[model samples]
Every structure is written in C-alpha cells, then in structure tokens.
Target chain A: MDMQSVITAAIEAVAAEQGKTLRPLTDDLVLLESGLDSLCFAILVTRLEDEVGFDPFTLSDDVYFPVTLGDFIRFYDDAARSQAAPTLAA
Target chain B: MQHAAKPLRRWLLEAERGRGRALLAPGTRLTLDALADTTGLGALRGALADRNVLVSTGSQLAAAEALVELDGLARRIVLAPPDLKPTDIPAVMAGAGIDAVLCDGDHPGFGPDVLIAVPGPRVPLPDAAAAEVRDTEWVLLTSGTTGLPKMVAHSRAGLIGAIDPSALAPVWGTFYDIRRYGGLQILLRALIGGGSMVLSQAGEPMADHMARLAAAGVTHLSGTPSHWRRALMTPETASIDPRVVRLSGEIADQAVLDSLRRAFPGVAVGHAYASTEAGVGFEVTDGREGFPAALLDADGAVAMKVEDGSLRIRSTRTASRYVGGTARALADRDGFVDTDDLVERRGDRMHFVGRRSGVINVGGLKVHPEEVEAVINRHAGVRMSLVKAKSNPITGAIVVADVVIERTFPDTDAARAQAGLKAEILDLCRATLPAHKVPVLLRFADALAVTPAGKLARHNA
Candidate 1:
C-alpha cells in the first residue's frame, strides 16, 4: 500500500478500535477535528511505523508534528524516499 | 539468645470475641479454631520444622489457613501469591532459603525436595495434634512488574504494628492478593485483632467479588483507589454496606474519596500510605485526599520526615530488611525507610504526587503521571484515568491519557457527549496542571486496566 493508503487505513483502524468515527481524511481536515484524540493518533503512528520501515517523527532533529492527514502521509513518504536514495540529512 | 516473640495464637486479640466467625471463601469456611487438632500437614510437620517454608497455596484462604498452623513451627514463612510467575519460583525459593514447599494441592515443581500438602480449612480434625507455634520471620514478596520481585522480611511485631490488639472483631475484606504486603496487613488485622475475613479468589470478576463481600456482610473493606473506582462502576458496589472503607496501594485522589462518600454514606473512608518495604506508614482519615502537614511534626508512633520532596518513614511497622534479588539497605543511616514517593506541600496538607522513579521527562520538564491523572480524575465525568508518555521525535515523549468515563455518561460516538467530556476534562487539566502535563490526547476507554497488584497499570508507549 502507498503511504496515503496505509496512513488512512491505520487511522480507520485506530478510530474503530477507540470506538470513534472519523470526520473525514481530507487534506484540509484539522488533525484535532478528525474525531480522533491524541492517544488514537499515537496508536495510529505506532501502527504506521510497524507497517512501514521507520517513523519520520523520530528521524528529524527539529521537532515536527504533522497537522493534517496530508502532512502525515507526506512526512512518511518523504522519509521513505530519503532512505531510498542517500541525500544530505540537512 | 533472645526469646521467640509471642506466638500468633497468643496474639489473637479476643479468643471468644466474635463467636462462630470464621475465615470464609467460596468453598471453605474455617473458624478461628479450625486447626486446633488437624493440620493436614501432620506427617510433614517434623520435616518442615525450623526450616524456611514457602506457602504456595492455590487460594488465599488456603494460605491463610496454612499460616495459622505454620508460623510458630517454621523458622521463616515465605508467602508466594498465586499469580507469581512460574519462572520466578527458583529465584524466590533460593533467596528466601526455602527448604520446603507447602501447598493446597501440588507444589510449583521446582522449589524444594520436600513438598507438604496443606489440607486447607475444610479438612476433618485428624488425630495429629496441632503443630508447635513460635515467633517466626514473615517474608512477603513485593509486586513489582519488572524484574524479580523483592522479598521484604518482617518480624511478627513489625507486620502487625498497625493492627490494634483489641476485641473489636469485624468481618474484613480486601481487593489485595493475600501474599502481597497490603493484603497481608488485612489478614493479620483480621487474625490478630479478633475478626474473621473473606478472601478474594484469583480471577473473580469485580462485580461477583463485591456481591460475595456483600453476602458475607463484610464490615471493613479495603482496596486501592483503582480497585474502588472499578468496583464503583459495577452495580454490586452499592449493595456492599461496609462500615469502614480503606484505600491503599495507589494514590487515593479526591474524586474517588468523594464518590465513595456518596456511595456509602456515613462510612469512615480513609487513605493510607504503605509499601512492602516501608510497612504501614500512616492513615489519612479526615475525608481528605492527602495527609495533614502536621503528621510529620507530631510525636506519633510512626515518625515521618520529608526531605527533598520524598517521604521517609521510621516506624516499627517498616520491614526490617530486603532478603533477595538485590543487596541494598532497606533503611538509611537513621533507620528511615525512603518511601521514594514524592510529595508537594499544598497549604496545610501535603499530597503524594507520584513515585520518584516514575517521572515522564517531557522535553526536559518533569511530569508525574499520577499527579496528572489525579487532576484529570477530579473531573465529574471521568471514572478513572491513566496518564502515560507517548514517544515523539521532537520532545522525545508527549503526555497522553486513557480515560474511563462515568457509566452514566453516554458516548455512542466520539462527536457526542464524549467530545464535550473531553473538553471539560481538558479544561480541568489546563486549569490545574501546567501545559506540558495536560494530556495532549485522551482516549475514552470502557475500562482502564489494573495490575494484578490492583494499581492502575501505567505503561509508556
């Protein structure tokens, strides 16, 4: 699955597990308003990390928290692409 | 050279106080004189004499019945709770110098060459006479989740210090497993202080256990605040009309205390501080969350001092020494056991914030999960909450929480009252706690998991 599909599926799984229904996974949808709490997001991140090879959240020196569904998917994809082809970390 | 302390039977506060009162459980009922003649271990009595014996009974009631007979005969009595990991048996037995294994049915297989069968309380009074009793060392295992459990050795007097030598016998009940320190205290209280006790069975549902306690007419009931909170959610809670209620093992937050007061009106609800290593520290009785500040200054039987935010206790109730796993002093130079429980002074009273080693380092700022959970639990809608850390690349970790809502509140969807409840809980946290300690995210769980020891299970992800 692509990063977007994996992230969306994880969100659905976590939300269902927490007995929550998602509002929408649109790019502009605010993360806090996505009917998922921080704990659910943490769980989603964990699931995504296990499905993928790494977590972008732990790779960067600068503190980063994806604010939306698009941002979360993009961060994972970027991390995956960067790992595929060696590039300067900066 | 010293004479053995008064034997356990001699410590019975009132031999004839509560007539017909017996140690009660699901299938067995043993009166105080249940072992006057037959002990089931008659054949092995000579083999176990003067040896360190491990009481690895199948049930707490069985263990209780065995302790009554084994105390004076055995040089050391090591209590092994039923939930002890099978792998920890060797370390525990070797550390306690266990020479024999006593059980209701079969032994744990690896402990010792000598395995003694305990007939429990229901055995027919046999021809064998009661075993000789004496003052013996009582070794209790600390319910630590990680690594091998610590073995804290205690003298008979030290273990029973909190128990008054009186004739007031009230049927006692507790949520603690009998082998742990807290449950042992309740057992000793019932035995030495002239009362019968109803023991909780392993894997019994909370509601069924409460119903059993109610059926047994338990007057003095005690448990951790987590145990009480989970119990309150069950419909059986209001049925058990306890005269005296006690909370230990975890921080008794104000919300739980208030809820208990409402549930059992006119009952004496109290919170006490105690640990396997520290013994029975003190009890806070004024219907408050934390103890009074004057407790440290007063000339009381249990001397306490707070230095560098940690509570230190010096009392006869404190365990004498650590027996196994690690070799470290149980008490300091001044005979004070460092509780390692941090506290903060709030005006005239001080509240236990959390354990010193349990801090969640959030971006270099320290946050105690118990302290944060206490604030969140104060919210009316919250039944119980567990605050723990979630790993984050930026700050290394972020505070998160799992909240169990009061049963009355409906949460069909996260967008319904749960959102409002979350907002209210977050507001409560923000109003009282700092920004960092405020749980960044809270998940609504039907129930929060509690450890086998009955404390809220706190695991950082």
Candidate 2:
C-alpha cells in the first residue's frame, strides 16, 4: 500500500525472475551494490513502471541516477507527487 | 592503380584524401582529414610499423580510423570488441599475440601499458610511413556461440576481394559494430566503395538510433532481422527510408522478410548468407527466405555445397587461419570450410536449419547453451542444469534453464528453498556469463529429460 512496499514488491518480482534473493531493503541500501545486477535492475524499473503507473526514469527530463534504494523510491515518489502537484495547483 | 578498383585503404585514402566525411555518429563526426590529423591515426601508422597491434577502441570513430589506417601499418591487426568484459580482455590480447592495443580513453585494465591512445591533433599527416600493406593479417573474433570466441585470421586482400562493387548511393547505415565480422563487411563495403556511413553506437535506444540514421540521409541500411524487427516496433521507424535494406547474421525467416517488405514498401529487401569462417556468400534480392537452389553449383565468386546437412563454402574471402585454440586446420584439402550451420532443402531453395552445434541465436547474437549450463552447474546447490532456447517475439530466441538441485527440503518449505537456490544459480550465471547469455527463465525440475543416447535433451519441452 505504501511507496516502499510497492518498490520492494517490484524488486522481489525481478529477483524472482532470476531466482535471486535480495538483502532486506533499507533506506541507504545501494541498489547497484546490492544483489541486483544491471539486468535485474533494468527489469525492476520496467516492472515497477507497470505496477506503479509512473516511470521516474522516463518522466524526468533531468537525468536522475539513483544509487540507493531510498533514492530510487523517492525518485518515483517525486514524479508521482509532481504529477499530482499540477492537479493540486488547479 | 585504377581509381574505381582499389583495396579498402586505397579507396578510403583517395575518396577522403582531402577532407571527406569518413565516420558519423550522433554526437561525433570525423572527416578523412580530421581522422588523419587529430585521431593520432597518423602517429599510430608509424607506431605500429612492422608490429602487431590490436585495434580495440570503444569509440566508433577511433575504431573506424584505426581499422582504415592500420591496414598498411601493422603486420597483424586484431579487432577486439569494446564490449568485452574487462576480465576477458587480457586472455583475448594474449591469445591474439598482440604487441600493442590502439584505443582511446581509459585502459580497459588489460596489458596496462600496451594501450596507445589514438594520437591527437597535428598539422599534417606524418611523413608517409615506409610500411606497405604487405601480407597484413586481419584477425576478428568469432561470436563464440559454442565456446570461447576464437581469433579468425584474415588478410586485407581476402577481405576486400569479396565486396561486390555497386553503383548505389554514397551514404550507408548499419546496425553492426565494425569490430565484428558482419559490421566489418558493411564498413569495408562503404570504405572500398567511396561512401560515408552513419555508425550506430551500442546501448543507444533503437528508436533514437533509427532517427539519427534518417537525419544522416542514409541511403543504404543493413541490419539483422532482429534489428529490423526491433526498429519497426519503435515509433521512429517511419522516419528512415533507405533505398537498400539488407539483413544478415540470423535467418531471415519468411515472417520477418514479409514484415520488412510490408514496413518498407517499394524498398529493396534482401538477406545475405555469410559467416566468420565462410566470408561473404550468396545474397538473394528476391525478397525470399533463402538463396536460390542454383547457387549451390552456379559459377560465381564463391562456391557452396551441402555435406551431411551442413553447408560448406570456399572462396578467396574465406578466413586465412584460426589464430588461437587448437592449431587444427579450418578447411579441408580443397579449401572448403564447414560452416557447422545445418541447411535443409525446402522447395526451390535451401533454408537454414539452425546450427549443427548446440548454439542458440538470441537475436543476431549467439548464446552457447553449454556455456550457460557450465556456469549454472557451478552453483553449489545445482546438481545438474540444462540450458536451451525459448523462442520470443522480440529477440528470436531467449535462454531458459532447467536445474536439478543437489539437496532436498521439507515439503512445506521446499518452494522457498527452491526459489532461493534458483536466484543463487542465476546470480552465479550473471557473474560468469554475458548478459544476453544469462537464462531468461529458471525452472527447477525433478529430473532433466535425456535422449536415448544418454545425453541431456536440448530441444522441445
């Protein structure tokens, strides 16, 4: 139901695709330095886009390179909030 | 020397001798004059004089320049793919017997000092080097679908002799990286034919790349069926309209051919049959799946035959030798080299029947099943593993693995243990194998199906 749980479920789905297990998710967990390889990270982003209905990587004009799990979750959160911000302004 | 009839180097020098567009990419463009002056290519000519050099630049411009200049400068030149993992570079360098590596940017952490960055800006080309393009050996790596990539040695003359002269346009675009065999053919075709090219950078988005090629006004475009399929799926496909569209590397099945024909109506669509060992073979422009049956014995530039279902080809352009690995002869007494690609007679033509060797083609790239299986088998909990191909709509085929675990767990928690082991095995595979070679699907089986011959069955569920 929460942003963190949504991100974690997507990550787990990708890890499940490769039969990989992830270290427990934490704020400072370096995604690249974690068990996820580049391919798994890519799949995670793609799957998360489908589940959450917004892909931060594509929506942001400014390139955002998120190294940690918190940065990744916040990236989507910021994109989602930004989408709602326009509505809030209206 | 006749201007129209010249080798790749001579044509490049004459066409771009003053200042001509030699290479083009999205953010980078190098002229013949710029290539000669700034790229340290002139200095590289002298530095590699009488020496064997490996042109392994990650930059497309640098690679094109190195390949063009090194033809006459180096006694032996090996073109190593820039995408090769850092850990795989040393063995490749040592195997190719390279004395120096011509690259730009950071050293890929191999043969540290052997890296000679492509030279920088100079006023004029270095005083004409005394080196003549002697029996200069051109070594290229075969896409190791069966085992480790092997260095296939070829001569400049042999490579150039195969280019079919064309009166087509000047601008060319190709999906191949010049480092590989298929890409080199396109590179040489443009170089020897006095044409410019739009180089596709690896890892660039296909839609954007297609748009770039369109913006470059590319008249002739060449790519694998997988590439064309991927490109068509992209929204930018409508932007590029090439006069000539060619496919190679993987089988151009009727479905792909028809789709390409439908997508690019009125454009010429054709596929050529060629391999690392066989050089360039017969090409069919009939918009069909395979070459005409008559090419088997027709008097042509090359010769072909089918022996025990495998196609064999012999021609001047065929590879000169296998540089590394077992010193086994590549060809038999009569010059015919077995392509190891099985072919079957289908009506009036011969259709490719997959590789006789157990190599699965994932798109245009080859993924050796045994190689992935070996990595999977290394996992502590994996008792045995069987890697095989699973067809996909995008990539022609993807890798899938079936593994039998070494240990058993209680029924309630068996699923959890199985999932854990599966992930571990995949992790091990990712560390050892290339990304494409990693199995897309991992399944834990009670037992792997075996053939009557007591070998693990590879195909069919």
Best by DockQ: 1
Q: Please write out the lDDT profile of model 1 over residues A1-90, one tens digit for every residue.
A: 778888888889778656788997898788889998665666666556667867787777777788887787788898999878866864
Name the docking class for model 1.
incorrect
Q: What is the C-alpha RMSD of each candidate to the true structure, in Å?
A: 7.0, 17.6
Residue pairs clashing, model 1:
B72-B133, B72-B134
- Root mean square deviation (Cα) for candidate 1: 7.0
Off by over 4 Å in 1: A1-55, A59-90, B1-4, B11-14, B115-133, B408-414
DockQ for candidate 1, C-alpha atoms: 0.11
Residue-level lDDT tens digits of model 2 in B1-461: 64323434555545536536557887877765454444355545566776778877777767887776677667788887755656666777777777787777766555555746455553455554335445578898876523567788887767777675565536888888878888888788777665678888877888888888988888888887657655655679888888889888766766567767888999999998878778888789999777787889888779899998889999988998898767579888999999987777878888775667777876677776655665675565655667887654335566788887656789999888888887788788778777778887688877765421123556632
Candidate 2: residue B42 Cα off by (Å): 5.1
Per-prediction TM-score: 0.84, 0.64
Q: Tell me the whole-model lDDT of each prediction, alpha carbons only.
A: 0.81, 0.72
Q: Distance from true position, residue B243, model 1, in Å?
A: 0.9
Which regions of candidate 2 deviate over 4 angstroms?
Answer: A1-90, B1-8, B16-20, B36-44, B108-117, B129-132, B359-461
